[model samples]
Structures are given as structure tokens and as C-alpha cells.
Target: MTASAALTVIQASTLTLDDTQPRVEAVLVGGGRVLARGSREEVAALAPRARVLDHRDLILTPGLAEAHIHLVAYGFSLSQLNLHGARSVTEVQAKVAQRALQTPPGTWIRGGGFLLSELGLGGYPSAALLDEVSPHHPVLLYSRDLHLSWANSLALRLAGITEATADPQGGKIVHPLGTLLEGASELVTRVMPVPGEAEYLAAAQAGADDLAARGYVSAHTMAFEAPEAPRALQTLAARGELPLRIWACLPHERLAHARELGLALNPGGLFQWGGVKFFADGALGSRTAWLHAPGFADGSGTGMPLDPPDLIRERGAEALRLGLTPVTHAIGDRANHEVLNAYDALRPLAAERGVRLRIEHAQHLDPKDLPRFQGLTVSVQPIHLQADGAMIRELLPHLAKTSYAFRSLKAAGAILAFGSDAPVAPPEYRATFAAALTRRDDEGQPLAPGEALTEEEILWAHTRGPALAAGWADEGIIRPGARAAFTLWDRIGGHAQALVL
Candidate 1:
């Protein structure tokens, strides 16, 4: 569309989220940018020959942005056996058994999204539980939080993880033969079937399209999967087949290679390399969240620390120098604390480079450390709160008061970017809205009720926060010269759909 061409005016109860003029009745678009936004009559008059779409009952806002997700993994997960809401061990086995029946006897069966707590298990589940159902097929099911994996005997034997197997650094192997925590899970995963380039491309396309259908115009894909994952996304973007804009990260291990290839942060594309990702600790669900002092109330130890502070400080400095944001995953309080320490040291370099230091998951933090998040980006997942609420209460009751502290982090001057760590939880915007606005868990209990945000705050976090995190000035807002990407909702964050010019 040319600038001289007649504009397309979208009429709705437009919540622009623009501070100067927060609400407008209509938005005029031309050349994929917001040309004008005002009252229906005003905007209509500005674009007299414009094609008008009238939906005054619906609410239109800036397009939603998924702040953190594993795009390729989520796409692959779409085809995997879903164990998301399986409430019992029997239920989990039944699903696995059903999947096994459809497959050849000896094929590996990979699935995830079940919590040990939800399974009513007092401790880590044994392979015997799964062996009883599918002794022939190799099975590996991950915990809801993706921090732990449960493997059946066949899968274990394939990986050569016998009773004598030693735990890898920064990981654990739960005895009695099934669970692998942190790095230890890689043992079985390393031997599993690797998706070829074609599979990777398909998964990337599936993930992007899925998010677009869910009203997301863009996503910041955190690097947890193999480098092939981003390569596939890049291929999709180059072919113009990717439906959503993707801001991806390079795993810290590849930072040297990225720098060698002169991979500076590139903005303004369907896909861009935006950050360098690191893991400071494990997750909460697997009882692997790194905590301080008394650790897990149940005496499960203070979780596991993955990347060391010195390594983060050194490598993070290199990432900042290369124009990539240092995105650290710090879910537990201790992890957050140590990461903050590293960020504190690297703050000067980050400021000098004009890159925001980002912390992913910051799930549980001490109140004293919360202030340190000021002037940084805290990319968090509110949807996880629904499932982690009960776990937080039981495992870290002392820190429950500040867990998933969205409102607090925002108040502390931290930019809060909301996302669904999909496959861990579906990228359902309603669940994100419900969890943030209501501060309620799945058990009908409120978790740190004070951390609840207003509908507007939630919307801003879902939109503007992510744009800022990715350093995209033109996205996540509806204004002059901004990208013409939008989401229309029946109510603010109710049922929604994407509209890209």
C-alpha cells in the first residue's frame, strides 16, 4: 500500500496503550503503519476514501507479544503426546499406553508436561510405574516445568543410564531408576532422534503459526533447544513463511561462534537474533529451584546451579560487547540473587552498549533483591503461576510472599515482559491475564494477592514490555509510524485474534 492510497480504518473500542491518548475509537492504517487514531468521525474524516471495518463492540489494542518461548520446541510439542493436565500416575500411563499402541513397539515415545505433585507422588516416580504400561516402547516424559524428565526402563537402557550411572555436573539422577534433573536429563535426550532440517523448519512454521492464531504478532524465542532450531526459524523468515515476528537468542556457549561470525544484534525483520541466553539454575516444579538458606522446605537441597557466576560475568560481558542482551534464566531466589550480582557488575557495560540486561523467569525473589531489578528487563511467565502456586506454598513457604512478583517487579522499576514458556504451559493469553489480574492459582487460592496487576498493566506487559525487551521501537504499540499489527478482543484480553496489515 502506498502512502497516497486510501487508508484502511479499523473501528473498535481501541485501547491504544499510548500514554498521550490511551483510547481511540478507530485506527487508520497505511503502508502497514498506523497513520492516525482518533474518534470514529475524526479518523474517518482523515481517511475519507478508506475501507472501513466496523466492529465497535470489540476492543482493539497493540498486537500481543510472547516475551519468552521455545518456538521450535513448542511446535514439535504440538505433535507430541500431551500430558499437561494428567492428574494421576494412572492417567499419565494411560496416555503413554495409547500413544504406544499407535507406534511401532520399539520406537521412542517422547512427551512432557506432567508434575510429580499433580501425579500425587510423594517423591520422584519410578520407571516401574511406566514399565507396567508400556514395557516395549521407550518413554521419556518431562515434568510440567521442564526441569525434570521421567524415563521408562527401555529409554534408560538406550541411554546406558544404569544404576551405576554418575550424575553430570549441575544435574541429578534420582535413584530407583527414572528421574533425571537438570543436566542429567540430557543423558537420555542426547541419544533420542534428532529432527532433521526439514523437521526443524516444519516445527518452526507450526510454532509461529500457532502463536499468530493465538493473537500473538511476535515472540522472543529463548534459546534452550539446539542451534538448528533458530536456523529453521531463520529459513522460515527468509522464505516469508513465518507468521509471527521472532526475536531469538544464541545459547551462551555459541557466543564465541556468534562473535566470530560477526553476528551483531539485528533488529527489524520477521526474525532477528536479539540476545544471548544463559541458565543460572533449574526450575521450581522439579524441586530444583536454587534457593538460599533453608533451601526447599522439604530438605531437597538448595536446588542446582547451572552456569557459574564467574562464567556469566565473563561471557555476559562478551555478549554485551557484541550488542546482544545477556538474558539469564534465574527462577529460584538464589539464582536470581547471583544473577543480579553478575548483572550489577555488568551494568556499566550494558549501559555503555545501550543494551538492557534481561533476566528470564525471576520466579521467586527475595524482597531485598527485588530492587536490584530496577532498570532491567524481567521476562516472566504468569501462566506458570497457576501451576506453581501450590508447589511454592509447600516447597518455599517462606518465599511464597514474593514469588511471581509481577506487581512488585513493575513497582521496582523493572520492565515486566509477560510470556508463556509454551510446552511447559500453552501460550493461552487468558490464562496469563487471569493469573496476573486475579493472582489466583489453579487451586482457587490467591498467591501473593498484592502482586496482582490491573488489566491495563497486564496488557502493557504483554505488549510494550516485550517490544522494549527486544529493542523494537515500532512494535507493541499503535501509533504513528508504528507497525500495523493488532489484536482485537471482545473485552480487554478476552477472546482475541490477530490483525496484521
Candidate 2:
């Protein structure tokens, strides 16, 4: 018998996420899709001779999806220096020195996950500390937010950046030459060796495998990486080596090029390009999130704004015309305000095209801007609350009540999609579950208790919300003809394992 045509009956305790028949005792599968879902007796009678796989002890939920992640980059980060919890510069130096001890003198070393505030620094960190540890090897490390980069002198010299090097548009070269903010990072990244096709393929495989192991059946790959990143993923799909279904976006600057190449929203596959991405501002940790007056309570000037709202407004319409979702990254109040204004202009056209606009990281918001998110896909990483909670209280206390407003956004008519933005944070759903349900941050402090969501709501955000955002009708639920992909759990929000037919 052909493998695709083989029949089986899976008996389990299932939450279908379908209002019509939310609970199912047995599911009949054939050709990699669910053929029927019903009581064990009913389905058993229909597929009498089908092989039976019983797991009545476990709970089966719709497979999870990482709503926002830089897949390939995350894969590569698996081996890079991880600095997620170092509380002091000395701690970071020790780790860098160890890595350098094992590496060749001239090899470049890279890794990231540090937060300035977490490190207890009031201003930018000097590269001298890193230089002291690894003067022979160039080192480049990114902050946990991915909005800033700290490099040692050797790395900076290699990038040809000095006091004479002017800041690139939309980026900054923090004086004293140790850190690069926003656009300024590109200067060094551009100078770094581009990964060849093989490295890209390896990263793609490693990333997809890691997520599959964590019970993610799908992911929406964000578009901050180079073109090779997507191409590598496409290669995997073509070779049938891809383990997770991918819905990816391209940077908005590629919109004209995309139109020329006739790339648009094409659904139905292991991979698809469904959105065009834009960035309105940087992240809060970097003191670069574009904000309204009184910006950061720390007295850092209003953060740097990246893409102009006019550009998002004009180009967003173009993306919608191609049946593509215009996804923008808006972190601070002013950034969200400007993006909401820009999306307002696209609303009519987006409605006409039957498209849902998306906003990534609606992290901190003005009360006035909260309601404006209604009807948009607010794709956020609940995992961020674990670290960002304390920072919000210290840096932007004015918005604390509304920051990461999960319940408020959901009540306001927004489709809340959860993700981890991995590499910045590990795509661990347990952390997501805890952070979302508790509304607490790193220090065991609650930021906005009222904004906490129930476990079920968090599941919906990680499943159905992302499916709807990607315009996938058959995923995020269990029904006849649905993809035969599920996540088995000991109980709701417990240990998970993927079960894809």
C-alpha cells in the first residue's frame, strides 16, 4: 500500500479548537490529512480495518506555531555564544575568554543576549571590557533585544568603523565606538562574511528540527535576515527536508523587486511567502523605541524611528494589492501610533482585498493606541514579558499598565498571535505559558495582572490566531480534511511532542 494512502485511527483525548465539535475521541487519518473525527465507536465503525493507535491518556491539541521568529538566524544562534543571563560585565568577559581560548587567534567570535539595564548600566557599555578578554579575536555580541550590538575594538576595526565613520541612515554609532544601534549594526554585518548556501541550509535544517522537537508544527519566519535565509528554507521545502510549515515575509524594501518578480500571497504548501515587512522603530531595551513626548522616563531622547509612516502607508497598499499582508514592527507608543495611522489609510484597501494587516511586537502602547489595534493581527512574544516586565517599570513606567496588554488587546478585537522571537528569546512555550498566564516579569513581579490571559487564550494565540494571520483555513484546528498534525501533551501546557502524519 502507498504510504500516503495508508489508513489509521488515532484515539486520544483531544481539544479540536473547533466550536462545532471541539472534543473528539478518535481521528481517522489517510494521505496525511484527517479523514474523520468523532467518538471512537463512530470512527472505528467507519474505518473498521484501519490500524489503531491509542493514546487515551494524553491530551491532543492543535499543533503550535511560532508567530514571529528569524528562523535561520535562530538556528545559527544555537551554537553562538549565549549571554542570556549574565548580570555583570565580568561574567560576560569570562565566557568570551573561554570561547577565545579554544578558537584560533584570528577567528571572529559572535553571540548575544545581553540587556543594558539588566547589566545595571546607565549608559552604553564600552567595548574595552570585551577587548580585555579577547584582544586577539574579534568579538561581536548583540543585546537580548536584537536592537543593539556591542563589539570589541578588533571587530569594529574590521568593519572599518571609526570616529570618522558616519552613522548610516536609520542607525547610530554610539560614540566611544563600542556599540552600534539600529541601522548602524548593518555596517558591521555587511562587512561580515556572508554565509554560503551550505551554511544557510544547515541553519535552516537545525532551526526547523529544533522547533519540531519543541512541538511547533509551523512558524511565521520574520524577514530581518538576508535573502539567502529564505532561499535556504525554500531549498529545504523543495527537498522535503523541512519539518515545519513556514509562512515567511520579505523586507518592504524588496516590495518593488517582489512586484517585478511577481511574488505575492500564494498559499498551500510546506512554505509560502505571505507578507511584506516594515520596521517603524527599534526596541525599548536599546533606548531606541520611537516614543511619544516624555519618551523614555530615563531622559533618553525619543527613540529613533526607522521606516517612515508615509512609506508604510504608500507601500502597504501596494502589498495588499498583491494579496500580501503588510507586516510592520512597532514597539513604542509613538511607533504604534504612526503605524496605526498608516494602517488606517490601508484599512479600506486591506478590507477590499480581504487582507489582515499585522503589527509585530506591539509591546508598549498608549491607551489611545490600544483600541486602534482592533482588527489587526498583533503578533507579540509573551516570552518577552519574562525579561521586559522589569525594564518597562524602570524605563517606561507610564505605559506599564498597558504594556503587553494581552487581555486588553484581545478584548479590543485584535487577533493576538504569540511567538518567541527566538535567538532573542528561546522559543520555549512553557515560558510563554507562564508569562502570559501570570503577567509577571523576571523579578517575580507582576507588571499588569489584569492583562493576564488564561491558558486556553494563550493556546489560541499560538495556534488559531497565527493560522488566521497567515490565511490558512485548514490549520490550527482539528476537523475533517485538516492537516494531520498535532501536539501531544501530558496535560494542557505541559510537555509536548509533535505528531505529524
Candidate 3:
């Protein structure tokens, strides 16, 4: 008996993409594998009992994948009151005050998505500002970029973070204002109540369901959440309730524990540990994007560097030794340059291990360093282009041409994996498709019209590129031996609906 001979069959008018783009026929899927794909008659002859799923006139392509996202954080963010488009400080304060009244006292209210530049404020918001609205309850509002966090005085006192507190390495406290940057955000978080197992599972299920509804069948989850996040996914998968396949990552700090637990790169199951995530620098919106030569267009100094290059290179090798892929966040030109340098040093090791090193948000690249990303996966968020467009024009106008340079990076031989750095930018694939293809921002500003990608390219980047980035050979494709996963839609670029045949 053939291995795939026992599975079900799904037939369509146009079976799109099997070793090539769009073809007519049927696919036999059994044991979660595409046993065979060919003309309807050919496949039907093999699995007569394989219940047929018909999408006669619909396009059947590989399932979509999100190359970069924070799973648990995105899930938790869904429950929090979002402040993503708040125009001014007063608006943010008002929103917090409203939530504060609804939430019980001292509930540790949290919400994100306020742009420093959009607020018409010159500097970052301070504890004093938030204290005005949420003096009784602890409030922590993260900047739109998720790089800087503003906490109320009550939250600071609870975390015992005083002015005299020393800045953690690669993090800073914004002077008398008392805002925490990067690693410093952890101090306040360490004191927050850790969610129980129930919250974790609920968030995971909710997060996964939301993505599935958006037509994403898979995602590469960047690690920033408690380990319970992946554990929750595993629970769902075990119960046959997982909505989408997941590739989970670990922070470099967790490598020791992973090794102690004897976990290696097992690329099966709905959830798999695929890479070790690192932050090479802060974010652009937070004014912490590490840049080279000329800094922000504004008078502020160049962005802050997060993880030292040498540290990344050293720890990256350690991760490679244990069969883990190295993924780093590099937003600014300088940050991208530093990560490229480190990756160059470790390329041989990564190649020997058959692992691909990825740099998240190769958002801005130095003209000189643009070629360095060749052959590397550039995981970028097109939706962020909507918000960062104005900032790019104002802060680094000279480099604006290459900012979120999707076409340039792809032309340079870089694999472009599109995603929404959810919570930083929400996971709206349709918006990503529209922004990348149109190259227009919310204000209809043409940030870089020349950098726009074609609709076909955008689709590939959203689907195949991300699967390749996660090293999932069997996903994001429709072919024999590939995962029997797909997404159905009313139209190609129209409404998306999950097809779980």
C-alpha cells in the first residue's frame, strides 16, 4: 500500500501551483501529506474514498505565512485597549483614564501603539504624564514601536524602579522623565503578575484563531513572551485544536534551558523551535534606531545600539552549535550593518549546520551595506510603512529611497519575507499586500514609489518567502509531499477565508 494512498482528495477547477504556477486538477492528501497532484481524473483514480473538497472556480495556492511576529504578546495585546492611532498625549491619557475606571484598581493596566512623532511631542512621554490619568492603578503604555515603554509612577513604585536605579546593559532610563527603554522595560515587567496557564492558553488560541481568520496558515513567532506561549500552542496541537502551524523561537537567554531540556531543532508538529531571536538595536519610531554617519533628521543623536555585535556573534555561534537558527532585529542602517558584519563572521558556521540566519526589519540599509543582505532573508513589515513613511521623509530623507526598500532588497537577491510585527504593527495581511503593492501611506503620501513591489511579488513574499525563511520546506506550497494546508478567498486580493480541507 502506498503511504499517501489512504488519505483524502481535494479537487479544484484550477489546482494552482504544483511544481509550477496554477494548473487544473486534484490533490490527494492523506496523513496530512499531498500524496499526488494531477488532472482530476488522475488523482480521483487513486483515492476514490478521499472526500472531495471543491473550490471549482477559486484559486488554490499555498497557505500564507507570517515570517515574523510575537505570538503571546499579540494575543495579550488583543485584550488590552489599543492606542495605536491616538493623535496626542491627552488622547492617550483619556483612553487610559477610561480603561482605568473599567478595570479594577491596581490591575496593572497595559496598552500600546502611541507614536512619539505623531503626538506632536518633541520628547518621549514621562511617568508624570501617565500618572495624571492612572495615578491609582499601575499603567504601562508602550510606544508605537514597542521599543520604549512609558510607566505611571504607581507602576514604577511597584517595580521599585527609582531614579537612582541603574540602567540595564543595552537599555536606558530616560533621565528625570522616568521612561524605560529596551531592556529596562523588563524591570517593570518582572514585577507584573505572571499570567496563569489559563490565560496563556486562551491568548494562544485567540491569537492563532485571529491569524487564521486573516488567511494565515502559519507564522514564525519571534520570542518575547513567557515560555508558556509555546507550551500553550503545544497543548492546542495535542488536542487537535491548533488552527495554524507555528514556528516558535527562543531568546538567546533561554538557550541554556533549552539545551538542559534536551531540545534540538525538531521541525515537525504544529509548533517547532526554529531559531534564537536577538535584538541588535532599538526601533525607529522610538528614536532608538542605531544609524551611521548622519543621525535622525531631527537634532536628536543617532539611535541607541541594543545588543553589541560581538555579543551577537559569540552567542550566535553557541545557538548554531545546538542546531538553532539565529534571528536578529536590525532596524536602522547602522543596526543592519552591524548584524550583517556579525552574520558574515558566522556564515561559515551557519552554512555548515544548514541553518539560515535571518535579520528582522532590515528596514533601513546603508547604501554601502545594501549588498550584504544578498541571499539573506529580510523579514519586513509592509504595514509599518504606513506609519513610518512620514518619519522616513523627515528623519532620514537621504536614505528614504532605501527605507523599507522591498524591491531593492529583493533585486539584490535577498529573500523578502513580509509580516506585521504585530503589536508593533498589527497582523493585517491584506493591508500589507496593499501597502507593499501601492507604496502609499495613510496620508496617501508616496514614500518611495519606486520601491513598490508587484502584486505577484507581494503574494510570494507573504507566502513562499516566509515559509523558506522558517526553513519549512513542506509548507507554503501546493505539491506532492507538501503539507495539505491552503487558504480560500472570495477573490485573490479580496476577502480571505480559511479553507481547512
Candidate 4:
């Protein structure tokens, strides 16, 4: 069909997710928007000459949205050495050695997605472990959670991190040298090579295209990478090369820069600046999650708090004043509690500014603090449950009941926005559906079966929840005035593909 076709009709077993008309047999789209949706004959009648494509047995739903991700990072991770499922130190060494053989000897080797626990490590791994594999290359492998990094001696020396090097504020250098936790990872990162603008653009494009191919129409890119990451996405969007809508966040550290540049929340377009992201604590896998009293049963200390409560409070108000949502990452119980406390104080300001307060990865929480999430956006990643399940049971046993409490959060009046923290976990919709719907761990055991959600609820969280979080009125819904982006599925959470009419 020509690009200027008057209309295109798609017929399927459709789930519009529009309360007014929940299900439709066909939908008519034109001008990149839905024109009408109804029974096959009715939609066809509305657009007599419309190009019709029928898939009567397939299920259709609003385009999926990934509420939290590091878009550019995910793209880069695609090309890096994958260590996602490495089960032992030997497996990790072998992977690094194989990559080392392919690369220049002195080049920096970077890759991640391995859990220490999964690697059979009783504690943080030393640089000596990676050294055994790639002694010539400066190797820097991030923990699965991305909160911890296992660096080789070469990399550590390149970053000037030694046994005597003091830990930076908000992060730790595990004793005996090699592992960096929380903000401490920056010690090496700052020394690692920075990708050029063109590289950044290519990474962003790759990431967006990857997500689009997997049926995502939009993504809320959490700001955890360099500024060039979002800049690249913006560059692609301006050139009409971006495949998915991007709602990006500015690093809270860049708040001053954004404010000085008069940047506020800009809501439409393929790419938009929507919020400022802050980390309240590190991640669970890193043993850096900020927990309440009686911390990890394994005694790794009460997790490392990243951004201080006062910082979130003061900077969050500034972000609210600038009409930007204060999106804080709080995976630990204490992290969530502290962030909720800050949000409680900033709620009035947020309301006055017409912005929503958002908490990313409210993974673990205290039962009493669940209600505090009321009227706020809770952006979570069910995909994480697949990996964190056993860790949660072992470390935060006391809070295990409320960890990833999707049902409880929803019942407590919180808006549920779902996402896969790509690179941390693959942005696979099926995995998200399975994790949320089954509440089953990697071992097929339920962590908290009562937290299981229905297929419809999971669909809403993946679609509408992200829309609300990004303040997009036209996306994540199938209606007359909405964007004509949809996902066709063989079954509710089965194989799916994106369709942009």
C-alpha cells in the first residue's frame, strides 16, 4: 500500500483495552491514528476502500510500553561479552578469555549480567578471579544488577583503585580490591573509554530497533547512563530513525544543567524529556540494597544507600518545581521506605506542579509502607523476579512476603507501571508475563503466589501504566484519537509483533 493510503483496516481477535469498547473484531487506522474499531463489517463500512489485513485468529492489544530501561546501555550490552548465565568462575573466565583472544591485548573488556550467587560465590569476587582469564586486557564486568562491578587488576590500576584507595561517598570498594559497589563503580567507569557521539547514536538506534522488533511501541529510559545516551536517542528521533517512542529521564546530577537550559517536561513526539532519575540505593544482587533493621540474613550489612534521603528531598522538590517527575530507584526495603518518605513530603508540591512522583523497582517493601505509594506511580520490573527470587528468600527473608508486591501495591491505590530493566534483564514481554502472572521463581516455586496478576492486569501495567507514568495521553490505548501502534499476539502473552498503521 502507498504511504498516503486513506485507511488501513486490521482484523483480529482484538483487545482494545478501551473500557468503552473492550473488544473489537477490526480496527480502521489513518493519519497514524485509529479511526474506528468495531465488528469486521462495521469497521470495513467506515473505510470502504481501506487496505484490509486480516488475522482473525491472532490477538491484538495496545502497543506495549517498557516503563524502565537503559536504552543505550542495552544496545551496548548487545555487543558486549554476555555473562548472563555463567554458572561458575571458570565459565566466566572462559568467556572473558575467548573475548580476549579476539580483541587487542590492551583494550578494555566490558560485559555483565552475572549474579554472584549464581556464580557460586560466597562473597564478593576479587579482581584476581577475572585476572586469571584476561591478564592483558583491562576487564570490567558488571554484576547482573549493574550495581557491582568485578574489575581486573589492570582496570583497577588504570582507575587508580588500590587496597588503600578510599571508597567514594555512596559506594564501596569491597575489601582486598577488585569489586566496586554502588557509586564506587564510577571510579573505573570514569576512567573507561567513552563512546563517541556517532557510537552513541548507533547504540541508541540499535536499542530502539531491538525493542520495537520485540513488540514495544514505547519505552521510558531510566537515566543511568551517560548524557550522550539520550542525546543519541534524540538525534535519531529528530531524523525519524528511531523505531520506538522514547520517554527519557535526565540524571538528577544534571538537574542544574537542565534547569539552567530551561528544560521542563515535554510530553509528545517520538522522544521526550519526562523526568529526572535518582537512585535511592543499590540493588539486591549486589548486597547493596538498603534494607530496614535486621538486614540481610547473610549479614552483608544493611545494603548501601546510594542517594541520601536529604538529596532526594531537596533535589526532588527542584525537579517537581521544574515540572519533571522525580523518578527514584528504590529496590531495597529501606530504600523504598526512605523514598516514600521523601515523596510523602513532596506530594503536595508534586500535585501543585501537576507532576507524578515515581518510584522505580519498588522491589521490596515493608507492609506498612505499601499504602504510602497511594496516588504515586510504582514502576517495577517483574522480569527481575526471575533472577532475584532465590536471593530475596535468602537475604531479605523478612520482607520476602512484600517483595515485588504487585497486587498489594495496586490494591493500596498505587499505579502499576511494568518494565524490564534491560541489560539487567532482557526486555522480553513473555518473561514479564510469566513472572507477573505465575509469581514463580527460577525453580518453578512461587515466591508470593498471592501477588499473581491476571493476564488483563499485566497487559494494563505494560501498556497503560507506562503511558500514565510518561504523561502520554495518546499512547498505550486503542481509540479514535490514539496512536495506531499495536501488538498482535498469537495468544495473550505469546509470540507478538508490533504493527504501526
List per-prediction Cα lDDT, in the order shown. Answer: 0.91, 0.92, 0.84, 0.90
Model 1 Cα lDDT, one tens digit per residue, 365-459? 98899889999999999999999889999999999989999988999999999999988899999999999999899899999999999999999
Q: Cα RMSD (Å) per model?
A: 1.4, 1.6, 2.1, 1.8
Task: State the lDDT of candidate 3 residue by residue for 188-232, as single tens digits.
Answer: 999999999999999989989999988889988998878888889
User: Distance from true position, residue 86, model 3, in Å?
Assistant: 1.2
How much is the lDDT of residue 32 in candidate 2? 83
Q: Write the per-residue lDDT of candidate 4 for residues 1-501, one digit (tens) a residue.
A: 333347899999989888999998998899899878899988877777888888898998999999989999999999998998889999999999999999998999999999998999898898898888889999999988899999999999999987889889878898888899888899999998889998998889889999999999999999889888998998999999988988899899999988999998777789999899899888889888888878899877887887888999999999988889999999888999999888889989999988889999999999999888899999999998988888888888898899999999999999899999998989998999999999998867788889999999999999989998888878888888999999999998899899987
Model 2 Cα lDDT, one tens digit per residue, 1-501: 233326888899989999999898998888888888999998888877888888999988889999999999999999899999989888999999999999999898999999887888889987898999999998889999899999999989999988999889999999888999998988888778788999999999999999999999999999999999999999999999999999999999999999999998888879999999999999989999999998888788899999999999999999999999999999999999999999999999999999999999999889987888889999999899989887898889999998999999998999999999988999999999999999878899998899999988988898889999998888899998888888898977889999999
CA shift at 209, candidate 2, in angstroms?
0.3
Task: Give the CA lDDT, 0 to 100, for residue 347 in model 3.
Answer: 93
Give the residue spans of candidate 4 off by over 4 A: 1-5
What is the TM-score (0 to 1) of candidate 1? 0.98
Candidate 1: clashing pairs of residues: none
* Model 1, residue 137: C-alpha shift (Å): 1.1
Regions of model 1 farther than 4 Å from truth = 1-6
